[model samples]
Target: GRLLNALAATGNEKYLEGFGPPAPGYKHAPLNNTNVVRDMVDDETAGILVEPIQGEGGIRATTTQFLKDLRAICDEFGLLLFYDEIHTGFGRTGKMWGYEWSGVKPDVAAIAKGMGGGFPIGAFMATEKAAVGMVPGTHGSTYGGNPLATGVANAVLDELLKPGFIDDVAKKGEYLKGQLEGLVKRHPSVYTEQRGMGFLQGIQCAPAVPAGDMVNRLQSLGMLVPPAGENVVRIFPALIADKAALDEGIDILGKAAQSFEAAKAAE
Candidate 1:
């Protein structure tokens, strides 16, 4: 449906043969990468869009090999590779960009979520050639590059580019993941497993226990996590969060899971 909508909006014949089944995990809703590129899009004209780390799609991290293959495929077809790293950029993924994990360079990339630390901002970065066709006035934004926003973004980038900031994000993310894994082990009935990478993590729980209830419970306990696809709780703490903050958040999450387990056991 999404691809169809995109194709319809573009009104380009390029999407005719660029159709592929869903990748491996979605066998029930098969969307192959090749079919997507070859049938639904014009091999030479259309661009390939992907989320390096799908923040809302259950925090699913794309496999390194899959990303590399996508890059290779895009290069072969003269297609642009675009990465939607809105939620994974600015050290959130323990790297400056989530695509770094796959060692793939996208022709175009979009980011926003973590750029302003909570302020509203959206950004798109592209290779010189990818943006070459865009003439001045072809696109303009009232706030896209406002001086104030630009200054803030510059500061954010400067801070993130510091030698140890991203490295710290990596270390803290590992710690958080380990803590969440332990919680899963201790509360097996409430959580099935831990998934995701960097500071983006999800706890897959039983469907009977609504993610809303968990979110409310965590909120009551002074913690906030988002609901991911299916019945999972997504955790995306600020990259600047430290060990103590992570521990506190994990404790709150563990308590919430235990409470859910107790309620389920009673039922």
Candidate 2:
């Protein structure tokens, strides 16, 4: 797969270790965040890579315990912790960085998505000790630190770090999850379950209902949700979204699921 290819190019040959696909009854499923990292990493490994909460991988949330274990393992082996918080940064997961929820910090991390607040931007931060060998000009992006991009990113961060901004995101995330859970309970025929942390949520629909079909239905209803690798629909609304907006969005999703079910029955 593309992921395997990309990883290979960056870090030499790597093997495919299967991961759990988000689906029916995943809430009770064993959390394997740390286990997977341990299985793959050893003394010679430089670092462990992870997404505290997987976005495109269907809003899958890594457990706090798993994160703690990863931190411990990394210390044990003198390995760096690298987080891909692209979709979970900028208070998207009710925190400035999703890794904070795990009470674990990474030596190096890449962040984007919410950092732009609709503008295009990306960044990678690292602890100097872990970046010991990354000399000047070792790696560069044509536009990585352009003045304009930096200015815009600064503005976005200014707003996000403002007092109560992240707290509001946390409140709204809980409220949104509450609403989605309600819908899941009310429409078990359509949604088998829900999983995610903070605003990065997913609704697992029937396996018979392809994720794309659900997204298209939601789009037709004037709402947009992204699909994941499995039969999961992702909800990555803006960080500033309020309860009212979240309620409306969830309502649209519920209706879309119902519509999909009706159409499926017809078929």
Candidate 3:
């Protein structure tokens, strides 16, 4: 489908194989390592595009120090910093936006997904200066400005911005995280410590059990977790999910892990 590959640009090997090399204007930086960022960027570089918390590339996060360093480096090098918060926005990361945790603002931000409250809409924001080149009448879309989409989006924003809505998301994320950590302790063979913040988390599995295998098992248990790089089973829970529901989901995943272990032992 067009939607499946529209988000298609990555330095990942699988992407390289499928898409035949990355686009010309991009550079790859190790998630939390700014040295690689410095080494790869040069005078010709226009800006840096980063994800505050990686989703499909695995549940990786950038350290606050690294994010701060990027801000400083981008300033020194005069590069615009863009954040792809498509997955981390709208309370997915417990924070209104994942970059908020580092206290570093992006010059431009791409956001979507949960922002629609089940409807489909995505938008990119830029600081006034950064947006100067985007003349008002030059850029326009047909379906993009449709009243129905815009109205639903506006209503969704009202709910997301309501007092204590974001706070509850952060607290629920903590609860879910604590439960996942317990699973790691109980089944060290099948799992590793959780990766990710808030409601977006992943369970790293050992090579003995592939992440795809766990994804299959979890599907059977009524959970539809996705797989990420380095053998990770990702769980992206709804922002409004409560502690009880999160616990039940995690419990089902734990049982799935145990079942996988037993099946492996029998082999």
Candidate 4:
């Protein structure tokens, strides 16, 4: 839950002002700042939307207090609270929902990514009370209700909810976290620290090493993971991944880190 205040993905409205003029009235609280959210609420404010675990923003965890405070603020203001759980949904975190750690239920939530099981599918859910305004024609998608997509999503959801599935994911995640932390300790010249929950995790590369360079090094060693903004290499593994698989990834990371350290020292 070390949510630091960082800008959003580049070119976003709040991120460098979308590389142009800003939107008329859009506003955002620094990632972990509670005051911004509080001050921004008013008659024109709709609600608050956020990612419990920021995947692209360096796998930053949302503090339990921060999430709970948002919930309380929304309730007090008679406003909706929404969650964009696409990245952290479906057991990416130890919990089924990133907000579940705080036990705050959102009025509306959007989910996708892992839910599709490699297919293209997405869904938005609103509590019965919050859904009253989202009538049939109010909002819909061209591919939203496809039978095949729904079928695949259902199968994926069923597997994720099966007994002991998420528990195993949590166990694997702890193991993986140890592996990443080990890299940080043993290869400090390359990675400064490890952060994240479950299979969704990241390691911050040192200033001397570029995250993209580390990513290429890992890929060359037979592991593939994307780079998160602000020089982070995300450690995203399959939900059903095992020790051997994670060990392979860690081994690759170790080799890559050593290589980067050696290169840095040479420089």
Best lDDT goes to which candidate? 3
* Model 4 C-alpha lDDT per residue in residues 28-103, reported as the tens digit of each score: 7777789988998989987888889887778887888888899999999998998988888888887887777778
Clashing pairs in 3: none
C-alpha root-mean-square deviation, each candidate: 6.3, 6.2, 2.2, 4.1
TM-score for each predicted model, relative to the true structure: 0.85, 0.85, 0.93, 0.91
Q: After superposition, how far is residue 178 of candidate 2 from its true place, in Å?
A: 0.7
User: lDDT score of model 4?
Assistant: 0.83
lDDT of 1 by residue, 1-267 (tens): 235553443233445346533222211111235545454544335667777776655777777776777788788778888888887888888888988988889999988878877777788899999999889888877766888877788888888898899988888888888988898889877787788878877888876777778889999999877787767889988777888888899889888887887887798
Off by over 4 Å in 2: 1-36, 264-267
Which residues of candidate 1, in runs, are more than 4 Å off? 1-45
* lDDT (tens digit, per residue) of candidate 2 on 79-106: 8877888878889889899888877899
For candidate 2, the TM-score is 0.85
> Could you tell which candidate, 3 or 4, scores higher by TM-score?
3
Off by over 4 Å in 3: 1-9, 16-18
